[model samples]
Target: MTTLNHYHYKRLQEFCSSVFVKAGVEKEQADIVAASLVQADLRGVDSHGVVRTAIYLKRVEQKMINPKAKIRIEKEDESTALIDGCNHFGAVVGDKALKLAMKKAKANGVGMVGVKNSNHFGTGAFYALRGLKEDLVTIVMSNASQTMPPTGGIKPFIGTNPLAVGIPCGECEPFLLDMATSVVARGKIIVAAQKGEAIPHGWAIDKNGKSTTNAEEALKGSVLPLGGPKGYGISMFIDIFSGVLTGAGFGKYVNNMYENWKAPQNVGHFFITIDVNKFMDIKTFKHRMDLYIRDIKTEPKAEDVEEIFIPGEMESRRSEQRKKNGINLSQNVQRELTNIGMKYGVSLKDALMLNHNTEGKGV
Candidate 1:
């Protein structure tokens, strides 16, 4: 795989912003969208990173997504609100919802927000982490397009349906966990297809509901839930909160990723934020959390287990290295990005550099 230097990645962010501006997104909103993508890459969520630029551009060209959306709060209560995203970019809607939730939390000690008419937002964790600085525990969930099937059914009926949570820690990085409720995210399948590689069995079923290892076959088929019915159940709940509560499209009503170019995906997202200080002394809670984490780390390990790590630890470590050494994107992604850059008159070298650089900081 080829790699982009740090400065180049920063340039990518700049490019994204510039293009978004050209497409009619406000400067501030463009920056937020770019930041969301870069943050995903920083946190090791490669699927949501720079590779998505091409998809966004195509969506704009097809008019499936609004290049310049006007978001507004449709309704509001003391501790909850509903946002009409006006078919904006998911990052824009998500950031707006998070800000609204935090504001309500400040006023009521806890807050929740539901958003609709959005597109793909990056990793759900990016939005959840916004609560950490405010001494709040945050949860973010999104109901994506149908890509996964029910536990025993053959046809697709649910999206990857991700759930993410962020908690303030005592001294370590905040406890952030973002994961797809499915066995694997559709992004992985896309990556595999790009590489012309086979996926592992159990990841997905063929069009006839039979298990398959070929990425292409799986794409025609349906992905599996993480733990059979248990994962399916959780996905359903996520769907209810993100889609049902928000009154967005659900189940088969959701738009197919590639097929629908002019219709809003009608994607929905939910944000739950709770101020930790409202119930207990913030310091005391931190101290107790620290003790709990310490005990968890000290627990006995089985053979072949060199270390026991919490959810966010590995991501933090990978981020440090990638920030310095630059990320090694898969060969297929590199090629695709290069091709897209060519269309926009951005040189391959410039695109690579943009992929490598940090967003706000100049390399």
Candidate 2:
């Protein structure tokens, strides 16, 4: 594994941004995509990080992702909006939607927004965190191409369908829950494949519905829903909210980002924001949240347990540490990044060299 300091990571992000710009995306929009991807890596969610650059570039080359997309509000009211992404990068569209939702929530106490024709939006938590600075509770969800099957079925009919929620606390860090309804995200399998590692059983089934351990095989198969029927139900509802409600592609109509290079993904996302001041004073809400988190953390632990963690606590800690100490990237990821950099006429080695003078060290 290679460790890269925050400075190096930033350089890498700039390189990615340059690639997007070369592919015809506006500089500002390219920066947004790069930042979103790097933020995932900073938070230790490598599955949604810079590893996706290759595929995204391919999509742009194929004209599947509209680099010059003009995202616009199709319909709107005081507290709600429908945005058409026009097939732009998901990060750009998601950021616009979240800001709109936060603006409405601040004015009306609550806000809801739906997005259509977007691409993959790094991580749901990224958008959910938009409302945190405003002392608002935020919920974000997105529907992907079919990768998981409903309970008692073998064929893939629903996507991983991730959901995230962020709630601010007074003394503790905000409570954030970001997860896929599937047992594991498809990106996890892709990562395993990149590392030439075997996947765990029960995470997915082969094309014939048999459990598989080979990551490559799992990629061609179907991921299992988390907790069986419960996860399936949650995923279905997410599809309805993010896809059906937004008039975006739903179920089989959604195109796979990796498979269908010629067509837009038509992915949909849903966002909701609630201002805490609407229900009670912001101070009171924060205090209650702190108390709730304290109780949960101080509860007795099971045997062999060292400590308890609130949602988003571990990721936040990792982000802070990575910013100071540096981030570790696997050799495979580094090599892939180098290739991408070369394609864009940038020297990854030079970029890393420039970071050696920074505060942190890279290995």
Candidate 2 residue lDDT tens string, 296-363:
99999999999899888899988877665655667887788788777787666654633466455533
List TM-score per model, in order. 0.93, 0.96
The runs of at least 3 residues in candidate 2 whose Cα sits more than 4 Å from the true structure, single-residue gaps closed, are 1-7, 350-354, 359-363
For model 1, give the 10-residue run with minimal summed lDDT: 1-10
| CA lDDT for candidate 1 | 0.81
- lDDT of all predictions: 0.81, 0.88
lDDT tens readout by residue for model 1, 1-363: 233444344556776676666666788988888878777777778778877877877787778888567799999999999998888888989999999899888889988999988888888878877788778889999999999988879999998899999888888667888999999988888778877999998899999988899999999988899999999999999999989989888887778757686587989999999888888988988888788888888999999998888887788787766665555566666677667656666555654544434443434
Evaluated with TM-score, which candidate comes out highest? Answer: 2
Steric collisions counted per model: 10, 0
